[model samples]
Target: MHLLRLRTDVAELLLSTQGAAVLGWSLDTDTGRFPLLRPARHDGNGAPDETAAFPLVPYGNRVGGNTFSFAGRDYQLVPNAGDRYRLHGDGWLSDWTVEAATDNSATVALSHTADESAPWDYLARQLVTLDGYRLTLTLSVENTGRDTLPFGLGWHPYFPLTSRTRLTAPASSVWLEGADHLPTEEVPLPANLDFRKKAPVPARWINNGFEDWNGCARIDWPERGLTLTIDTDPIFSRYVVYRPDTARDPAFAGDWFCFEPMTHTVDGFHMPGMGGLTPLRPGERLEGHIRLEALALQTGYQRATGKDYPGP
Candidate 1:
């Protein structure tokens, strides 16, 4: 497998052929590393670790099989886990072809064929660009299948955790999950999964999805003088928070937590009326964008460049 690395004064990001996934991104000034999406866990050397990295294409945490019925026909996908529902779509695990690369950006593309034997074909492209303290990712997926298929998109980025790390976002409700990790109910935040108050991640395990989130969220590391503000286009409405009990690992204990922005819930396919299933016509495309801006938190909300809000 080939891995591509990109670095700038502000941050460093890694891209891998397997799943054409973004594997790692870290701020240049911070001691902590931001874990990119991967399907299998691996050490820094790129060898597979027992744990899975991040899943691509269909990002965030997706459960259930990758099979769904569309237009009265049931379709099945190659399961990432044998005997289980397909997970994270097929792109993240598949090798993507690098079409272009430059000092400031790179583009990778992949195509799938639809036939009676494997009837879901599409073309996907990912573009990564670095601009000062901000990095932007844009992705597009086009259906090449003769028949329409259901789809969605998202990003899985883990941020470093610190005593001063704080998350601020406007969310109306949160999903309550059953043992299987699927949402059973959508309840108001704070009363349940709220993080607006900047509560330290509890020692107890948490793998829950939330909905009705604003298109923006912020992560502040006061001690490090770093602040990351993430803004997504309206297409991304859901977010998933995962705090794994990595205390036993020692290597990654209290290191990071994931703030996943997704287009919908884990099993949106089974939700009433297929809540998050996006349908694409022949030759049609699905596209989304995410922008991450980094700044230095000063007396109050100052840009890293020392410019004030609405500065000249």
Candidate 2:
């Protein structure tokens, strides 16, 4: 496994070419050591799901029926994982090549060719950079096939979940999940599901998609004495928050959760307007960036110092 490391005085990040995934990321602050994302189970040797985070290229989430019709042509996608539907495209399952690298930044690229199994051809690139206590990831994809297709982008980042972990991301509505783990309906945010304010992630199976996000979110780990703020490009207006338990994932131990920033809704291929998936012609491209800043919560006399307060 080829792994790249980016580090600063206060933070460090590990990336692997296997899936262009973040193996692990953490911070060393005056308060303590904080694992921003869940530590990888076996470093770069593990699968993307076992890593801290991975890219969602071409599209994100599952596409219902694994088929869609665009511009009078129909396309079918094969399930890339054990899931019933094609999930997160193929970026997380394919190996990427290193395009560039430095002490604090690295870029990885992947090229996919259309086939009967999955007919979406594209070239994807991800740039991971670390500066001080902040990390930024910029992902871009270019349609390289003959037919025009709807394309999307996103990131699947897992954060350590603790008893005191809280999330705050105001969204207009949420898509309820069906038994098949696919979205079933759009409804007003429920009190238990609402996070307009800082709230604990409900301890149940949650795989809903949030809509009309303001491109910002926050995760507070009071137990770790640190907080992480997520800022994304306007192109990514939707997000999915997932919380799995032992019932859904036997290997799960309630240690982590996912707050995925996506450019389109899950199963957008079947929704009107393609759910947010942009129709791209050959040579057309789509891009987005996500920034994560880590700050140490102030103690007794520790005055606020760092980026201006990112309001909720």
Question: 29-81 in candidate 1: lDDT tens per residue?
Answer: 43454332222345434432222233346433454555667689876655454
For model 1 the TM-score comes to 0.82
lDDT of each: 0.67, 0.89
The digit string of per-residue lDDT tens for model 2 on 117-164 reads: 788899999999998778999999999988888999999999999999
| Cα lDDT over the full model 1 | 0.67
Tell me the deviation in Å of residue 43 in model 2.
2.4
The superposed Cα distance between candidate 1 and the true structure at residue 127, in angstroms, equals 0.5
Q: Which ten residues in a row have the lowest lDDT in candidate 2?
A: 299-308
Worst 10 residues of 1 by lDDT: 46-55
Best by TM-score: 2
